[model samples]
Target: MTTTISPSRKTNEAVRPAKQPLRDRLVRLQRRIPIVQLALLVLVCAYGLATLPGFGSWMSIKSILILGALVGMAALGQSIVVLIGGIDLGVAGYIVAGALMVTQFATLNNVPFGVAFLLATAGAAVLGGTVGYLCHRFRIHSIIVTFAMGSVALGLAQLQVAGAYGGGAPVWLTQMTSPVMGTLGLPIPPLVLVWAVVIVLAALFLHRTAAGRRLLATGANPRAAELVHIRTRRVWVLAFAFSAVASVVAGVFLAGFAGNVDVTMGNPYLFESLAAVIIGGTVFGGPGDYSRTVVGVLLLTVLTTVLVGQGLTGADKQILYGLIILAAMAVYGRERRLRDQV
Candidate 1:
């Protein structure tokens, strides 16, 4: 004899919560993806701070945050362009140009901070728009146009500087670059607060708004986006414009943080920003998956600090950075393949 259960009882049992299988839980955690980046971040921080005697100081933390903030800003912009299936090689140029223009306006022309900022912003906008136009109008690869623009920007910056440029940031900007608060022997840089605020705003922009969703969708599948009557060109233009804004912001803060900017200052940011985005689990030319890319930026900053403590040369750091980028790219490629197969 067999007992039969009532349908209602079966339904109730089905709806009841149950413990997830370990394998299933692991799969779910893996799917979250960013958790991997978070884990890596923790691992790196722990290793660096534990091994390096002077790496865990408040000064060290603040230094990392300030540098990370600059890189994070660039990564944020690069992520935007990459989300739309494009790369902005011109970011370095925009950054350098913005930094130079800001200082030149304030120091050379003696303009107010507000006016100088607007002018720099306008310059970046025009540059961004030009890059977008080339991509849209000529059907050129974003890389080609942006790369050329980067060269042009460097030249422009050099011309503007005219060989000698020297100035200090305003008192307000200086204060922001310095520490804003401290508690329990830990000093907090205002730049960190600014970075956090920007991250929150970016998270909201990318997740909460229809426009942001549209941008991501466009990047993920331009053909499908166009089929759905989404203005894909406009999205691309918007992405570049936003990127320019980000680079400019980074430049302004970099000027304040470093007390000035040189022609070569923005060079490293080009690769560092891309690495941060990828390591943070955001794939290039895929759906914009920014699981707090700032974490990746901070990890790199910590790594840099650790390397410096170990007296590693720039070449050593570059090699390590390149290896990490390649590894991340492989992971991204594999994830994409698995997604496609599924």
Candidate 2:
């Protein structure tokens, strides 16, 4: 033990660097991703302000926020489902259905708006829950299940409307989304405030609640979750149901924002919601939250505005979105799954 090392051996030992602990590396990676994303957000905003006309103006900024809010709302259910290792392809269908049913119920059935709203959301929840239960019971992939269900939903919605698509939103609904609209006289759109409240509530629910923990456990490893008595199937059903509800609400708000309802209006959100979740660094299981999604929503909104300012066509924008999503998945996909980490 007392033998002296050779000079070369001593030099080699001195040059060798210490390996970082695995936990430390993991924590660093978690921190680094968000920081990099935030930096990118800031850079994009600064560039927009510098180059895009009126990009720094309140009107321009408000428009971005409002658009981001709509996307964020639609992405809410996608976020929940994806957290549990599933995807919801039916969001667009639910959005359109909710929009159509709400208007039709109020106008044709002569029901109160509140009753119509309830009926529309309730119908969406039923459809979504059925999809969730079917996928879990049959051990099928959610993508297939949700896609077929979405088609069914769209078909039913079309029948309900009898092919007619245009209708004005209620005045209060429009006011809620108006830039000049305020909650409690705050001078900001009530819709934006509602979005903010949703963000807070969602963060709290996912991070601080027992049900949230169960949901995460189920997603991380269903087998392990079951061993501990967590009902994975119930989690799936509830998650998709919630997703349907969120998408429908977003549809309702979108109708107001657009001042009318159209069957195809919700189509863009199907892709955009998924894009926002992935771009926000939320993996398919565990460790992602609504806050990351909010960041993603903002990043996407700003980027789209800049692209519009640069006069990119709709097709060009779609191409860019695809590329950006690919790049994001490439980076985030390499991370170890939650079960693997365990």
Kindly report which residue stretches of model 1 are placed more than 4 angstroms away from their true locations once superposed: 1-28, 180-187, 337-342
Clashing pairs in 2: none
Candidate 2 lDDT for residue 310? 88
Error of 2 at 258 (Å): 0.7
Return the number of clashes found in candidate 1: 0
The alpha-carbon lDDT assigned to residue 45 of candidate 2 equals 97
lDDT score for residue 283 of model 1 = 71
Candidate 2 per-residue C-alpha lDDT over 1-342 given as tens digits, one digit per residue, 9 for 90 to 100:
598889999999999999999977866776445765677799999999999988998877778889999999999999999999999999999898878776754676677878878877888888899988998999999999898887777788778768667656789998988887778967678889899999999988988999999998988889899999999999999999999999989988998898878778888999999999988888887668888888989998999899899899989989988998999888777767888876
- Residue 202 error, candidate 1, Å: 0.6
**Per-model TM-score versus the true fold:** 0.87, 0.92
Cα RMSDs of all predictions? 3.9, 3.9
- Looking at model 1, the pairs that clash are none
